[model samples]
Target: MTTNNIDILGLAEINVNKNMLRILEHMVQDKFKLYFTTEGKKGTGIRFLVKKEFAVYVQQFQHFEGRIGFIDFYTKKKKIRIIQAYINVQDKEKPQVKRLYKQIEHWTNQCLNSFVKDIIIMGDFNTKWNEYEFLDISHWRHDIFNYFKKHFIKESTLVFCDDISDMYTYIPNNPNHSHNKIDYIWCNIDLMLSAIDSKPRDVQPVIKTDHRMITLDLFMDDIVINKNNTQKCQPSSKTIYCYDEMQKTDGEWNWDKFNKDIIEYLDNPNIKLTTNKIRGINSHKQLNQLWNLFRKAIIHSAKCNIKQKKMKVKQNCHPLYDSDLKRDLNMLKGMLNKIHGTKLDFNDRSIENRQKIIAHITALYRRSDGNKSNTLSDFISITKRHNIIISNHFLHNKTFQYKDILQDTIIILESKYINATYEYKKNIMNTFIQERNQNYKTDKKKMIKSVLEQPHTSLSIDKVYKNDNNKDTFYTEENEVKEQTNLHFQMIVSAINCEKDLSQHPKWQDQYQSKHDVQHTIYSDLMK
Candidate 1:
């Protein structure tokens, strides 16, 4: 499906069960709209996943699981139906094989019985027209091939092949056995005429499966037009699949409706809400049980009242697609070609396949190794290059002794942010400082060290200021000198309150000074 673009794709001989399909649906739920078969067992079951873009066009789909499936596309003109059939036989007359074709014939008629006329039947027929190297298949092929021919249908892939070897879809593991041309694409003459190749093409087994992925170039004549916007939808072009239809089902999940429905459902007496289902939520095990019940209740209410809204497409979508109902045989002349415009490739397997094969192997390699120097420089590789002749030739007759370059680079930036060559500026600054100091001498008398016990004001909390030698700030809150003075005052105040019993406590010691002693000491510092 990936070698070329495809709008709708169906798989045969897949063994995915319903449970497994649900898991796969969740993984790709955002991308594809999945459809399943009615067959109970998993073996050889058919599965269809329409791409989100064209899923809007899928009006209806039905399948018998492992046997046969058909999907109807709602085209602008009429409906176009595509059937996927997987019929396996042992090359012998059997009622089971006949019954399968009877079912297929019935399904084909069902597609034609309604408004659907342009029907495409494709899949693994699992049997060639001839057995022993295209010998004859009149006995069995007559019924099947001629039956489709009545409606102007023909095999799109194998019948047109000059040699089966050029396009063998399925190859058996046993090398000795002949490869088979069992897979095919059969379509209505109206749709076939619009095909780019008419005859389906085959891409080699880049895939791991034994069956070579067959392809067809279809719906090439049309273009997507919206007012002034035009999307050149080539298979190789990066196409933006519009999933608005699939994702916008019923518009969006309505919380109001959901809540109302849940409340009503819980109140309904007919629906039992017993202790078995209403498991307690006290412990981990009970909580898990309760969670399961809660989820089920939500799901039940959701099904009853919460279908959002279906997206609608205007009939006047494209004038190219418009046609009168009272047409002759040319009604479907270009309908199939127009379908190639969008969403039909929703089932393309390449979308998933592309994720696995990281597209730009070389680009990733270059990015990670971008910094590496593949060609090493000679001077740079050496341990020492202080004397490397940089710009030697350009400087002087192929000699790179550069004064301006070295002078700008090799400057002493010791304590200063910038380099300066003026030693006179430094001497002038020193003379000015000495002049200022001489002027300040004897200008004011300096206060001698005295009982300047504490700082007059407290520091603000906006920011803390500290000097390099402020050791007490490291241990506690105050400066070392201020802390000691504060402690001395605290002891004096305590001693004054209990002067008679000051000696009774060892903590007070005998250093409790009296008022006369304090007055004498305080005056001495003031006098100094």
Candidate 2:
């Protein structure tokens, strides 16, 4: 719990059945800024705990009506958006379930439209498929994966590294339920490649939740540098100060006051100095000693000039924070929690009436004295008294589609290529088997001739070899060909449609060459 490994943590299924909210708040109080989004029902909610420094850069916090939300914040001076979602394990074919999927897509599409290119789509998706989960699937989940893939995003768990093996992030503690790798962290491919290590920590209970924490470790420099190639506005020069009022004063030169105050303090009867102590000290040491004596005198004189009441007030407590309304408000919230529980129902008429009464009482208490206290009760009372009229504004709000409309040509060509490749491979494999069986009784020379006569069959489907030399020639090495083909496909799709350079992109490289040396190097740094 005291480790320094994580900067941001996303948790799903907070199990609102228990007192997880208050417990979690206490657990991460001093270290993290905990934000929770729930439907205010049992067993539903997603929480994000971000470090305090990182929370300062947060520009937007969008909370949805379901178990999904996103926080767009800055880290390393780069505005990175992190979206966390929790898909319920239910009948996926249901209309409501399909609508949930659409909600995720709509939110993600909105994120992609933002200026921040480095986005992380992560959390408990509740899917079983692991390998190429985002690409090969053709169900309701397919839409989510396809959108990421088409936009050149890649799964962090799939990136090849010796330390990261295929393992499940979710394992029910109850022995009857089997483990599954449902939780995931999908980062922009470029951002993942720079990772020193990226994988799930372990399938363990965190705050009694049923999912493990996924970790991504990268160099600090990699996160801070802006590689998006976009112009950014300069940060504003503003200072926030919280200091004692005695330390602040507006005045012109007051040398006479300074000298008189200083001389009076230094000339007091209590002042004493040893002759031997001064005799033993050198010029440089003497100057420091004299300055310290004079500084103490100035401080003591300034303190004495302030009245007793003002000094006592400054010494005892903050002038702004002490109030009777605040005390009543705190007491009221504690009483409500004890009586009704942590989950308050704002929609219930009985509960709403009680809340209104409490607000009125607190407002009366604040108004009794001339003290200005912006208590929660004051706001509630004001809200009840004044309602903003939105008569015609609702008519203009239309249902505009947020789904990405991909180019027709790109979709047609991509579909054709996939189908063609599948068919070609199936036909070639069938022909190869038939020819080998048919030529069982043939001689070695004839068999060789028959196999060679078989129309062009090669494992490198995209590569073409020329018959220039007498010696047998083959396509490039297995790894090289695969890399080339992967790169080519990424380039074609990302270039023409997505406006992304796939070959040079970090995410693309991690996807195809997951087992490459660069990935190994990334994990090596993490291990160190």
Candidate 3:
């Protein structure tokens, strides 16, 4: 579990099932959303927890037989891929290790083919670096490094930290065992270079886990609206306010009509009072009815005021100036659109042209002193201000707060929202599968013809069995394959048998509870 402020969290091992996952979602649905892969039998798995703000941007998730989890998503229009893996602990499990690497290679190639360049791979490799006896390690760190290097990914620990080899990410409780760094975060070379800053955080041993959590922050250049503006585009807050538009008011409230309605309600003979409830009210149901009466009165007043305001003469505040500014902005965008429509190569000349147009637009909104207006520095500034106005109109207006009732309402609504979302995603996946199957059926003939024209074969092996002395070591191919298969199966079984029970003490719960309590208090206070 992670604090709500974190944008992304990667959890290596956890026992989570569909029902349990739904419960987790219900708890954090308002703040974060989850995507995961679980080993079915035990529900032991890895999960990628993305903050709600970033959930919509997650385009795809790839789960690899419960060993790896990958996500492809966009942030500020930048396509980035994240891969989290938990490798085997045994040294002799070469087949598993190779399979993991093959998956990485396949994913990297797939991303490249799709033109998504930036990638970050992180997780527990279960191997420590040994400069003197690298060959003795089961899950060789050198091989891992070499494999990543081939895909142009560099370990962030080594790239961003000094004396990287001396850093310890995992520490065993046993006195005889020494601490060593095995977990890692790797990023594409280009992404690293483009990042404005990158660093790692060390965890204290008191955290209760044998492996210290590794956190890396890679800040990229801010997205600016134009060359003339220096301001950055910040993401908007998730909290939004909505109000009923049909209840608009333009004049002062009709107090007489409102008073008459309240009088009639109070004089109704059907109304009853009982001693068990507060202030002679029968139950919460009666209190709610009174609250609704008050609400109706307030809304009626606002609507009457809105009608009066609508009758007044409208004011024209710099109509010509505003219109001209908007026209200039649209014309600039049109020019850019025309250039894009031409399908010209993105060479220096085209880029220069684009810059010139942007600068010209910036000049239109420049201040009298020949400096750009602070509010117009970025497009987001305008949208941000609009949102602020709307939120203020809804939130700052006088309102009532019923703590226990409101909290209960929020919990109920969140549960329904999350369940609906889950079902929606499930429906989308089902539709996609059905459509894919139908397409395959429709293209069967063409696919078969293409396959017949260019028959596929197994890829070439990098190494084959050989005799060092050039002696004849020939053996039956069938027997050799069988022996290799048996060896792989035996290694897997042995590794499973040797696996340690790494579950933490039940008392070692995530610090999320206290933090969530604080957040709830703050939110409740704000609502009040």
Best by lDDT: 2
Off by over 4 Å in 3: 1-5, 41-44, 131-142, 196-208, 220-528
lDDT of 3 by residue, 60-145 (tens): 88878687888887654356888888877576767777777788778877654433246878888777755422444443435766
* Poorly placed runs, candidate 1 (over 4 Å): 1-3, 38-42, 91-93, 112-116, 130-134, 158-166, 198-207, 220-528
Candidate 1: RMSD to truth: 35.2
Error of model 1, residue 165, in angstroms: 6.4
- Report lDDT (Cα) of residue 64, candidate 1: 62
CA-lDDT, candidates in order? 0.53, 0.58, 0.57
Candidate 1 TM-score, C-alpha based: 0.41
Off by over 4 Å in 2: 17-27, 131-137, 162-165, 174-177, 203-206, 224-528
Clash pairs detected, candidate 3:
91-138, 249-305, 249-306, 250-305, 250-306, 250-307, 250-309, 251-305, 251-306
lDDT of 1 at 423: 44
Among residues 3 or more apart in sequence or in different chains, the pairs in candidate 2 whose N, CA or C atoms overlap within 3 Å are 189-507, 190-507
Question: What's the candidate order when arranged by decreasing lDDT?
Answer: 2, 3, 1
TM-score of 2: 0.40
